[model samples]
Target chain A: MAFTLDEAQRIVSIALNHGRDAGWNPLSAVVLDAGGHPIAFARSDGASPGRYAIAEAKAYGAIMLGMGGRAQMARAEAQAYFMGTVNGVFGGKVLPVPGGVLVRDLDGAVIGAVGVTGDSSDNDAEAACAGITAVGYTPEP
Target chain B: MAFTLDEAQRIVSIALNHGRDAGWNPLSAVVLDAGGHPIAFARSDGASPGRYAIAEAKAYGAIMLGMGGRAQMARAEAQAYFMGTVNGVFGGKVLPVPGGVLVRDLDGAVIGAVGVTGDSSDNDAEAACAGITAVGYTPEP
Candidate 1:
C-alpha cells in the first residue's frame, strides 16, 4: 500500500476544512509517510508561529512509536529511555506525548500519520484523528 | 541582515555544483536563517537516505554557534552545553560538530549558514564553504 502524495495532501486539506468549520483559528496540518517523514503540510494564516514544527514533531512521534495520544498519555505506557532514543533518531522532531494520529491499513499495517497544531492540544489531536478517519483508515485506539 | 530564501538556495546550488564537478555522489545541501532554522534546501537524486537531517543539523549548528568548519570542530569550544541542549532540543538534529559554513552580511552580521552532507565529512565541509564563498558571503575565518 503505497502512500501517494495526493492522498497525503487530501489529509491536510480535509483536516484544514474541519478546523475552519469547527471554529478553530488558523491551524497547521501535517502528513507523514509510513517512515514518519514529512510528506505534506499546510499552515493557515492565523496559526501560531510554532504550529508548523510542533505538528510535524507530534506526527513523527505517533507514527514512529505506533501509538495514539490516549495510550501514550496513560500511566507508564512507555519507558522514558526508549522514548528518548526514538526522539534522538527523529532528530528532535518526535513529540511522543500525542496530538497526532497514526493511520493504518485495513490489515493493521501502519501507513501514515496526521498532525494538527494551533488549537488546544486535544483539538489538535481530534483534527488529526478526523483526517485519519476521513481517509477511511483506522487510527490507533 | 536577514537571510533571504533566494540567497539560501543559491548557496546550496553552488555547494552542490562544487561536489558534482568534483565527481562526488549526489548530495543534500541546506541553508538556515539567522535563527538557526531552515530557509531552503535541495537534495540531488541519489543522496544518502538520511542526508536531509544531517544537512539541517549542520546548518543549524553553524548558524547558532557562529563558527566555520575547522574552528567549529574545536574540542574546547565554549558552546558545548548549548550544543548538547540543541541535541535535546532537536533530538539529535543539532549536530554541533561543524561541516557547515556560517554566512555573514556586509555589516558582519551572521545572517545564515549552509551545510552539505552525503560525502566524507571533510568533503561536506569543504563543499559548504566553497558554496557560501561563491555566493559572496564570508565563511568564518
Candidate 2:
C-alpha cells in the first residue's frame, strides 16, 4: 500500500503529541516517503530553528538505508571511513542519528520513516516508535 | 489556516497529474510551509535529479518574497543590485523563476508555496496554479 499523505500527517502528529504529553521539550518531526522525499513535517513552537532540517535529514537517511537510524549508526560505527565518504557523497543528507525509525506495513514492506528531534537521542527514538505503533504499523527500530 | 500536510500532498499530486495529462515532461514539485521548510515533495520518473533542488528553491523564493516566482522575477529585474545582495545573503536559496506560486487561505493570508519544474517556466507555473485551485485555495501568480 502507498504511504498516503494522511498516514504521514498522522505519524507526525502522533509523534509530536507523544513528546508533548511526556513533558519533553518541544519537538520537530518529519515523515518521509520510501523514496526519501518529505511527506509531512511539523515543528512545535519552542523547537529550535534547525530542528526541521535535522528531522527531515534523519528520516531521509533511514529511508535511504532501508533501516532505522540507530541501525544505520551501528553500521556507521563499523565502517566509519566508508560512512563518512557516503555522507559526503550525499551532501550530508545521511544523518545516522537515533531518532529516525522505519515504518513497515502489514505486509512487511518498508513504506516510509518518521524522525523526531528536540530530545535526547534515545527519547527521540522512543517517540518515533510510539508514533508508528499508534498508527498500527511496525516501527523498525 | 495552517497549510496542512494533506493539502500539501494533494497539491503536489494535482500539479503532477496536470502536467501528465497535458503530455508535458516529467516534473518535480515541492510544497513548503510558511517558514520555508519543506512539507511535501515528489519527483516524477525521468525527471532530472536537479529538479528537486530547483523546485524547492523556487518555492522558497516565492515564500521568502511573499509573492510568486514571476513576481519575484519582476522585482529582481527592477532592483538587480538589491536582488543580487539578497541572493548572496540567502546563499542562492532564492531563485526568481516562473513555476513558483504562493498559496493563500480563504482569508487571503499566505499559508505556504508550491513549486514545480521540468517544463517551460510558464507551463510549470500554470500547473502549480491548477493544483491550488483544485483544492479550493488561492494561487497567487
RMSD in order of candidates: 7.2, 5.7
Tens digit per residue, CA lDDT, model 2, B18-97: 99999999777888888887766676766664676788888988888888988888988899887778767777777787
Clashes (candidate 2) = 0
Error of 1 at B94 (Å): 5.3
Query: Over 4 Å off in model 2, which ranges?
Result: B1-35, B38-55, B63-67, B73-141
Per-residue C-alpha lDDT of model 1 across residues A44-114, encoded as one tens digit per residue:
64454466578878887777678765565552255767666767887877766556777778788888777
Q: Which segments of model 1 are wrong by more than 4 Å?
A: A1-33, A37-52, A65-141, B42-49, B74-98
TM-scores of chain B, in order:
0.82, 0.93
Error of 1 at A60 (Å): 1.3
Best by lDDT: 2
Give the Å shift of residue B105 in candidate 1: 1.0
DockQ-based class of model 1? incorrect
Which 10 consecutive residues of model 2 chain A have the lowest summed lDDT? A1-10
